[model samples]
Target chain A: MSITVAVDAMGGDVGLDVTIPASIRFLQDHPEHRLILVGDLPAIEARLSALSADARARIELVHATQVVGMDEPPQLALKNKKDSSMRVAINQVKEGRAQACVSAGNTGALMATARFVLKTLPGIDRPAIAKLMPTVKGTSCVLDLGANVDCTPEQLLQFGIMGAELVGSLTRRERPTVGLLNIGSEDIKGNETVKQAGELLRGSALNFYGNIEGDDIYRGTVDVVVCDGFTGNVALKTSEGLAHMVSVFLREEFTRTWWTRLCALAALPVLRHFKARVDTRRYNGASLLGLRGIVVKSHGGTDALGFRFALEQACEEVGSNVIGHIADQVALQLEKIQRPAVEPSTTPETL
Target chain B: MSITVAVDAMGGDVGLDVTIPASIRFLQDHPEHRLILVGDLPAIEARLSALSADARARIELVHATQVVGMDEPPQLALKNKKDSSMRVAINQVKEGRAQACVSAGNTGALMATARFVLKTLPGIDRPAIAKLMPTVKGTSCVLDLGANVDCTPEQLLQFGIMGAELVGSLTRRERPTVGLLNIGSEDIKGNETVKQAGELLRGSALNFYGNIEGDDIYRGTVDVVVCDGFTGNVALKTSEGLAHMVSVFLREEFTRTWWTRLCALAALPVLRHFKARVDTRRYNGASLLGLRGIVVKSHGGTDALGFRFALEQACEEVGSNVIGHIADQVALQLEKIQRPAVEPSTTPETL
Candidate 1:
């Protein structure tokens, strides 16, 4: 059976220009895959017309009149964006029309729509979004980049389980080590939520690596690092900012000294290869896990090539049977498992 | 008439090897300055003997028998470490015998001791640590980096004022913009702490840059970024890790192909220059602000040279008279300020 990736053709600015072509390119590169484009028939067609004739035949367009605005209120959009390409894309996966859905849209909206349309997987309390980050040694999977800002102890534990399963399937590691992102490596450091999360994670079968410090993220210390979206997002942003800052600084420093410039001349070959590994585009598409169907959220500002790269990643997710793998793990770890009695509250903690 | 920096000579591993030599270099470099090294006389004397004979006459040592262990609790250490190099260092500043104190020791103990000895300025309830992070545009100061984890509305407002003044002192920018790190650029999205702080910051005279997303840190969008210690520590660590990751990855990428290797050689000059700009050693000292005196804390793992850098930084802070400037500003901005009629409770509300 061939893999099918449903493209949300209406969300991002580059959706039409980039997603369609990238989808075509990915399909061409992987002949064992089928493509289903979900969006307005004509716009996608106009964009699709730009593709070479032979490649056009490999594409299939599923018309949907709705489009989820990239900036729509997440909650409100999920309720009303029933016909949106993002929702329709996920619906295709649910209907077995596609293997997974891919979109570069408002993160919250996509997550909300995914939860609403496809529903969370069995034994899953809430869904999480995991983004692949390029680390020093290899790639690190960072979860809850922006799924739920306020998660419970159980939710965090679920994230750890979910993240472990996802990384296990997608990466070379079979049983990836999971880390709880906290202020300190010691047990006494994190807030109450993290402390409780640690105890719960410690009990799970997933390879719990205990507490990991913020500085450990890029050190390639663990395969997976888990945190709520608020902290995770900040961490992600800080990383990006620092990366940019450092490179800029290095450029300035080397150019100032003629001798260092000579050293730079000899080091160029190794440096470019290293730069590619850390480039943000290398790990662009984020997996939307725990939802009923596979949905990938790519950066909204991605270019045509970036969109294509995301499409390639989506294909990898489909080809690897990653979702099925996660579902299996989720079944073993949580599906039939008895849940402890606990209060589920949505009120914010007063601090 | 002379600038004196109290050296916590008993602190860290290198002690005077790093401390004494750096101070000697500074005094040699600046003949206008004076030094009062505070620590055990015997150890300092043993280390001082190694210094050049000419440099010995310019230095002064004050004996203080106690030393604060890195593992000691902040409160207990402050109470018991009367003879600690940290205590004596701050005390020297308190007695107006020294203009600043520099230590590579237990940070919490140093903070507590400094606070205890120096006392908070009249309007300030707590002091903050300001770390100057290298940015695309030279550098930016991030305040409250692990000094205080959780902040109140009034406290955040004070941080903004404090951070603003610190930035002004370094960059001399009038009305330097202060950005409050948050989930989104919009003021509506953050937690209650951020929102309440935003309300307070907006009301204050300091230039409020509104919400700054995490990516803004490297963008050099603001002069000062203010957040509680918990978040600040996360940001700082994340940045450090990312920089390391980037350097490592660039090394890997540049070696993948001969052509890439050639590219690496070509880019070597640029990359080396980048390292110097982002080098943490250039910006390692964390200036203890809002204390009665200038107390700079160096990273505990620092080596002799790093200790020397901290010493140089301390001398600069003293010469700059940053503490006195902040003290004056606190008096001017806060003395006549009207505090809110209602006291905010510290109890966290569970939703």
Candidate 2:
């Protein structure tokens, strides 16, 4: 079966400049996959005309009259912009016209629209935005990037279970190691919510590695790190800022004098390799986990290469049936634990 | 008047090897400061014997019969180890024997012991651990590293006030810009605590800059970034881990080939400059803000250079009367806010 993905061509800062070319490249690379570009018809069509005939044949365009502004509030977008490219792309998955949806739109808008359109997987109270990040060992997935800012202990446990399922499916491992992102590794560390979540995780069936600190996220101490959306988002942005600052500083040093510039030329390949290892673009796509249907969010500021990676992520998730895996695992875990009382509460005030 | 600082000479991973030399160096540089080294008498004296007669005159040794282990639980250290160097150092501040206290012992133990001995300043509910971090624009101070893991909105407001006072005192700025760390700059972002804190900060007398995300910490967007202990600790450690990994990666790249090795030699000066700019040692000492008296926590794994920086931080805080400034500001802010009904509730469950 061919996996069809809806691309929000008018989304993100670059709009069709990046999304259109990315969709074309994705179609060229994966012949078995199909793409439906949702955006302004004339603009997208113009970009599509630049693609090869074979690539063009692999794609379909759905005209979207409205474009959700990057800074618009999620509530405003959700209530008014029904025909927005971001919403329309997600609606494709809702209507089963596409297997997955990819957007580089406002994260808040993307999350709100996708959740409203697709609802949430059974046994999953709220959908979480999970992203892959480069680590010392390899890549690790951190969830609840900005989905649910406040999470209960039960909700956190659900996140852990869903994270384990996602990692297990992606890595083809029976039990992927899961760590509760906390202040310290000690049992007595973290706030009450985290401590209670730690207890729940320890007693659960997951391959729990006790508690891991924020440093553990990059150390690759675990395959999945679970935290409240607020913490996860803060950690993610802080890492991005630090990574960017380091690059800027390194570049400043490397171009200080003629001799240093010569040294930079001599060490170009090593620098390039290092850059590739820590490239933010490589980790652009974020999985909107726990959704009934697959949706991947690309960074709004990403270029075409990054958009292509997001499209690839959508395709991979569709092929892997990650949504189904999480739904089934969560249901099974919920049944086994006999914690029918412990439903994943979606209330932020309860936190 | 000569400032006196009590040093936990037996604390940290390296013990006397780092502390003894660091104390001597600090005293030699600052002729007006006196240090009372609290630890095992013989162990500290043996290392102090290596210092010149001029350096030794500015130092006094106080025997501490017990030593707190690095991994020991804070509650255990507090309840059982009264004579531990960490406790004795804090006690000196309580007894007016020293203007400040410095320790590189178990962080939890230090906080617990300090809270017990020095207590919190008037109008301050909890003492936060604030540390300076390198940024694109000089450095910024982030607070509540791991003190109050779960905090109320009002407590967070108090933290912002205290942080501003600390930054104002250190930077000699009349009013330092303060930022409340959140997932987004929008008013709707973050958990209830953060959102409410944002409102409280905006309404207060502080130079509030609204919400700042994790990236803002390194962007030098504000002078002080206030957060709950749990989030602040995670962000702090994550930055540390990322910085360390960047250096490790850079070293690996610089040593990859013989040509790269030659480039490394040529770029030695630039590398040294970069290292100095982002050196962890330069930012080692963390201020235990909100306390009645000043206390600085050194990194447990610091070497002599790092320890000396920590000592300098203590001297700076003592000279500036940072604790007094914070206490006065908090009291004034509390009066201005007219929130006498809102006392800082120290319960994590309330979060």
Candidate 3:
């Protein structure tokens, strides 16, 4: 089966420098796949002049005159920059020209444009940003990283269902364990929203694993960890800050003296092994789940290798029909509870 | 000037095994300081048999018939266990026999008992848990770590005031910069509560540094980081989990094979330096701020060294008069706002 992905080649910090190379490498590796590179046509052509005919034949260039700034507000980008590469890429997915869309552009603009163009899957009140986190056992999926500041209990249940479907389909797990993120593992803990969400999760048809704390994200205790965006965003950023501090401290210790530097050289191999096992590049892609079509957001400052992993992530989601699985799961859940399925709204909430 | 701290002798997971030795070491180090050990008389006397006469002269033992279980409900412990060691230690502070109280028991019970016995300072709505977090530049103090699940905008402002005063007095900084924890640094970001709190913080007398993200906590962007208990607790626990995972990953890599083991031996000194720089025991104690008396809660599973640090934390708070400073700061802020200071209520909110 051939799968086509629309690439925002003019997005991210490095723009064409990272995305073009990553897209070329992705196409070379997967001959059964194709890409529609959306950006400035002449600039993209300059970068692709060195490619062979066979490789060139598998790529399509879509011209985009405007580019979204890295700090552009979501509303302005959605209203003004209609011809932006980020918007054009999402249009491909909306128009059925591509199976998925991948962008390393401004996250807010990407989310706003994608929601405006592709809309959301039926019964999903809001789209959630789900990311794969590296865990001790393997990996876990955590959602609502920063999409919604405040969430209702019903919205939290939707996030859980979307996350569970994403994980189950991608990892081939029959029923992924879902945990409600809270301050404590006990049922009687946390604020009113989380407690209510726990009760709803327990009563749902999903495999609810009770409440889990912040530490459980990396413990691999559950396959899907669900929480409101405020808590999830804070936890994710805190982890990043700590990780960066530790690395800086390690570098400082390793170069404190000539003897220590020599010792660091001797331990280089073991350090490399440890680094590979927990590389952030391996988990660069974040899925914008609950949308009508698959959309993957890559980190803006990542290199070609990191962006390639994001492309691979998009391919995996496409191959597994994540959107279809999530839609079916939500419909089934709504039916079980006898709740009426709401029609998908055209005007979605802005980031 | 001499400072006296009441110690809960039969508290924590290890109880007397950790607390007794830690108390002895603390008294030995601070020659001018005294301790009131509150617990079972017979067990306390048996542990003090080996102490020197001079050391024993600085210690006073009080008998308490009951011990609060590590997992005891706060309301149950407050209502039923009238003579519990945790309660007795707080009672010493209430009776003016001790300047501060240090415990390694259940946090919820400790907070409830301390608040009930000591009462909150004038104009302070609720007590917050503040802990010193090691940052890139020295250490930063963060507050409301699981003290109140739901906090109002006024309560968040109170937290900021208390945390700033705590950091300022402990570090001897005339004006410690305070940062309100938010999902983003922009003023337009965050939920309604944080946005209103940001406005309140800016309008107050604190050295407000606008809004800060979770990464800023470790970046040393501000001397004091203030947030509600829910977000603060999750961030703190998430940091602990990530730190533990990194150490575990490092160990697994070091002992993977004989060649790696040899490399690890060579890197032992550098590794030791790295470990010592980020030692969790160095920052063990968490202060319950806004209460009338100083109370420090130590980690329940810590060893004697860690518990002694908690003792040292209590001494520092006493020596610097943290509670007086907080009371004065809150009063000054309240007077400036033209708000009437409510009389201290007999029935305070429970955990």
DockQ of each: 0.51, 0.68, 0.73
DockQ category of candidate 1: medium
Give per-residue CA lDDT, model 2, range B173-219, as digits (tens).
77889999998888877877888899889999999999999999999
A20: Cα error in model 2, Å? 0.5
lDDT of 3 at B329: 86
lDDT for each residue of candidate 3 in A169-199, tens digit (9 for 90 to 100): 6788879999998988889999999998898
Name the lDDT value of residue A16 in candidate 1: 81
Interface Cα RMSD, each model:
3.2, 1.3, 0.8
TM-score, per-candidate, Cα-based: 0.89, 0.95, 0.96
- The alpha-carbon deviation from the true structure for residue A149 of candidate 1, after best TM-score superposition, in angstroms, is 2.6
Docking class of 2: medium
The regions of model 3 sitting more than 4 angstroms off are A339-351, B339-351
Q: Please, what are the lDDT tens digits per residue for candidate 2 over residues A1-351?
A: 699999999999989899988888888889888999998998888777667777788788898999999999999999999999999999999999999999999999999999899998877788888987778887788987878888988789899988887777666667889999998888888878889999888988889998998898888899999999999999999998898888888898889889778867777787898898788888889998888999999999999999998888887788788888888888988777656455665568657
Off by over 4 Å in 1: A50-57, A249-271, A319-351, B50-55, B71-76, B250-272, B303-305, B319-321, B324-351
DockQ top scorer:
3
How does candidate 2 fare on TM-score?
A: 0.95
Question: What value does the lDDT take at residue A107 in candidate 1?
Answer: 84
Top model number, TM-score: 3
Ranking by DockQ: 3, 2, 1
